[model samples]
Target: MRAAVFTALCISLSAGAHVLLSANPLPLGMLAALSAGVFAVAFLLAGRRERGYWSIAALLVPLELAADTVFTTGQHTCYGQSGGPVAGSMRSLGLDLLCSGEFGTPLARMTARGEALAGTAASPWLLLGAHVGVGLVAAAWLRRGEAALAGLLRAAAAVAFRPLLLAVAIVTVAPVRSTGRPGRRSDRTRAARPRPHLLHSVLRRGPPCPAAA
Candidate 1:
């Protein structure tokens, strides 16, 4: 019942991306974005409700790929002026190799040429790859019912979904400066450091560890 409701909501949301999505007639990029969101949320809810993260995770792969493909495949033109559904999506997606915006957001931008309609800002492929990798791990975790494995997956997801979560947090609630949080005091000291010296050192050597003082 929960899964049903969850799936329904996804479909409803995606309908906007799909219906409004288009290069020529169909809004493929929008559709794909909507689909990705729906599947991601659906899988998460289903996993929790049925206690079958693996099952949901398995289905999540194709759903993600399909959403990615749909949005990517029709986003841009390959050899022509504009995309023709398939080619457009493909060309749009291929651009992601250079950048990483799956949902047409900023962090995904490498070149100013990346268009929002194309949904070429984020790397849907990277995201899809991570999902695939996690799914494999989930397979093993399910068999052993390892709570540790579950925790590991949760940690990975927390990190993986940080960008999305952060965006939501920032948009919905402005980022608040740390309130004397632990180690936060060092933030000011760190900021006051000589940038040139730090840059030269970093350039000469990789990230430094000053534990020895």
Candidate 2:
């Protein structure tokens, strides 16, 4: 379940990036709302006891890709572009590759010159390859049983160690001393109480002396 949720989250982030890079970008508010919705669903799935929610990941991947493809194609068309949907999608994919350093200067030049049609035609295959590669890596990581919430928390803590340390320092420097002072008065009262005289009690409780008997 954790693995599935993680995969969905990764795909969602990739889709969000695609939206941001598209020629007609979505408003930041809309993107934020969409992301919040996705995350809320993912959070619910993560907390579920049953594994049925894992199936949603299977649906999210294709949905995300298709949405990105459609959005990119629409943006290109709306901008009075010369290329078709395939070319537009290809350019988007190329841009992604360029940003990620998977594609070199040649592809970047082609995209820059609006000559990315040929490359775009070949991009679907490349996109599939990239997805497969990422999936394999995620699978390997998940197979190690390292996809739990605890692992996520540890990763977050590791990444935010400096801030966490600062927070700890702040709390330590300004410790909240208890105002009620719970054990102090109790301790003084107990100390002031007179203890029983052991010897006196023993003699008083002793059986009548033999001489008195």
Candidate 3:
């Protein structure tokens, strides 16, 4: 529960800082400093666990994607453009890709479409990269002697535990009985065996008790 709270707080502060830095008219240098401070505090409060950092990434990434969708649709509407939902979604995805620093003809096309918003001098790519970088660092730090990739995979699994558990439960079932019939039979066989005595072997005799009497 404490981990969850810490994760939530870190993600919330990071998301808020990103939005303020991107959409507000505040001084870039000051915003950057404040954002850095907030992130440092969040990191310290969240502890040195990979899950906390991955939790931050898991929450922040989706948020940025949603924000991109809203920003794209709002910008188009503001410009009196009539792009439908599909087009708007595509534009949003393209913008998200741009924010990830995946530059190419697709980004050029998006830029040509006049999707750029004012007061966004702070690049989304930089913000996302920084977030991911921090996550990687945290994962590395927590991994210790283990492989970084393994730690990252664990963090990813931890973040997606609910869905993973559901999938696993759907695909598998518990056994109806722990012990099989064969196991019970073996126990019975052991119990029914006669006990051996040291005197029986030494005093072995034929069935002539009546003749000896």
Of the two candidates 1 and 3, the one with more favorable lDDT, higher being better, is: 1
What TM-score does each of the candidates earn?
Answer: 0.29, 0.35, 0.26
Model 3 misplaced regions, further than 4 Å: 23-122, 135-213
lDDT per residue for candidate 2 within 135-197, as digits (tens), equals: 455445443444465567778888889788888899889665664856788886986799877
lDDT of 1 at 128: 53
When summed lDDT is taken over every stretch of 10 residues in candidate 1, the lowest stretch is 98-107
**Candidate with better TM-score, 2 vs 3:** 2
Worst 10 residues of 3 by lDDT: 96-105
TM-score of 2: 0.35
Cα lDDT of model 2 overall?
0.48
Q: Report the C-alpha lDDT of model 1 over 144-188, residue by residue, as the tens digit.
A: 543555677889999999999988878998665775755666887
TM-score-based ranking = 2, 1, 3
User: lDDT of each prediction vs. the true structure?
Assistant: 0.48, 0.48, 0.45
Q: Tell me how many clashing residue pairs each candidate has.
A: 20, 0, 0
